[model samples]
Target: MRFRGLLLGLFLLPAVVGAYLLAGSATEDGTPRCDGIIEEYGDAERSGPMKPGETCDLYDFADGRSQGTRSYDQQRKAQEAKASKDGLVGGVCLVYGLAGACAVIAGRRAAPAPPGSRRRPETAPRSRRGGQAPPIGSMSTRTGVPHTRSTS
Candidate 1:
């Protein structure tokens, strides 16, 4: 039983881990090299009151700018989302895995009966002797009747 459970876990664990890993990778600010950008990048805390930084920029752009924010760090949200997504995937996989395991177990446990196997009758036993039990017919009291009649 434990071995089967382990196998099921093996089948589902990677998918769950992948979901978490991927969910954590979506980021608002990313690392991009811009050869044309003269602006420097600095940490929010390191830069003082007159802080200046460039998240992203390219040589050609009508807007000539990228997004900026006073406070924008998605590390916590990303981690939480990753963990939840992983847990969700794990849960779903677990359900299907458990179902498969149950089906396999039931199939293994049920044994097919051999040929000529007889089920017990619901009613009491009856006389197996063929032919009429006795004969009956209209006759005088002196003549003992022996007429044909159905047994069943």
Candidate 2:
């Protein structure tokens, strides 16, 4: 039982650590940093593939004026989404991991029953509605009545 609990705790430890790391990346404001929209200037036909490390002059819709390079303003929306997803998964992992560890610890402390003895005494079977039936052990099958046993 102790070994089983230890194994369960070890298995869930990774999930707890992973969830902690993921949760760290989550934003408090819940606002996306990048929209990933590339704005095209006048004359779409004349526009060509922007070179690497090259800055394109573009209009800023938020600022209501034409401003700096498009490369700098370009949003990594995909990356942000991935981060958010990872954080959520991590949080879930952390919860399950901690819960599993607790369960393991609790299980390790419980006592095992002795051999050749039932854990609990058998009782009358329950009905479909959850009501207890008459005790089968003391009842007579032929007469459908309880047998009396006297101790004097």
Candidate 3:
């Protein structure tokens, strides 16, 4: 059983690493963007207003002018959804890694002796007379038993 656990842990190690890598790859950049229509006010000296659904920095909307738009709400929801997904993936990977570590540690522990293979230490039999007891089937008997011939 211990050997089996060791093998299982070894096999799971590679899988856990692979899973962690995969999760890492799926993660998005830490940049938060506006998913709604960005309406930027600019004069002839600057570029025109941002197009619909264009990525915009959250700082641009810090003035609170566009906070009530549907685009802002959509951006917030998207960010929240991504955060939840990332958290879940990280949690799963952590749990898997912990389980694999436990399995390896448990497998390394000493195995128990097989049934009937253990030997008990030899001990002398107990006697009421405080001496070694007689051999089995001897004429001498225990005090509790009545002898066929009476001492009288």
Candidate 4:
């Protein structure tokens, strides 16, 4: 039992560790670059955040900048999705690890019987002839009636 518990713990340890790492990453700030800028490029010079030195001459009426960028809501939603996924995986791993540890501890503990405790005899009860049990439906010599097996 102890060996089996050890094996179980070893196998499930990775899952627990992975969940912790994922949850930790999810908790960090995930804000993206160029959040407030709302400039739709006419010629579509840039599709994402560009370097400060990069020249994008396309006129954007919204933010007056040519570089295209994601809105704040989009970045926030993506972060939330990642966080939720990580949280779910971490929760499952935590629960499984705890249950497995409990099982291992329980298996290692021995039953609390005293050293001199009396135990029930293992030998089967002997009939008058000191032989094996009679077959079912056999008539008893003393009763002399067909052995109608008791339902109870």
Give the winner by lDDT. 4
lDDT of 4 at 69: 36
Q: Tell me, by TM-score, which candidate is best.
A: 4
Cα-based TM-score, every candidate: 0.32, 0.39, 0.35, 0.40
Question: Candidate order by TM-score, highest to lowest?
Answer: 4, 2, 3, 1
lDDT of 4: 0.58
lDDT agreement with native, every candidate: 0.45, 0.57, 0.55, 0.58
**lDDT, residue 88, candidate 2:** 74
Off by over 4 Å in 3: 1-39, 43-70, 111-152
Residue 76 shift from truth in candidate 4, angstroms? 1.9
In candidate 3, the residue pairs with backbone N, CA or C atoms under 3 Å apart (3 or more residues apart, or in different chains) clash, namely none
lDDT of 2 by residue, 40-102 (tens): 454432223443443445456687675644453242344456778778778777777778777
Residue-level error in angstroms, candidate 2, position 99: 1.7
lDDT of 3 by residue, 12-102 (tens): 7656765665566467444445543444555222222333454444333456454344343455567667666766776676667767766
Could you tell me the lDDT of residue 100 within candidate 1? Answer: 61
Q: Could you give candidate 4's per-residue lDDT for residues 26-95 as a string of tens digits?
A: 6656553343333344444333453433332334668676544334555556556767777777777777
- Ten residues in sequence with the least summed lDDT for candidate 1: 43-52
Candidate 3 local Cα displacement, residue 49, angstroms: 18
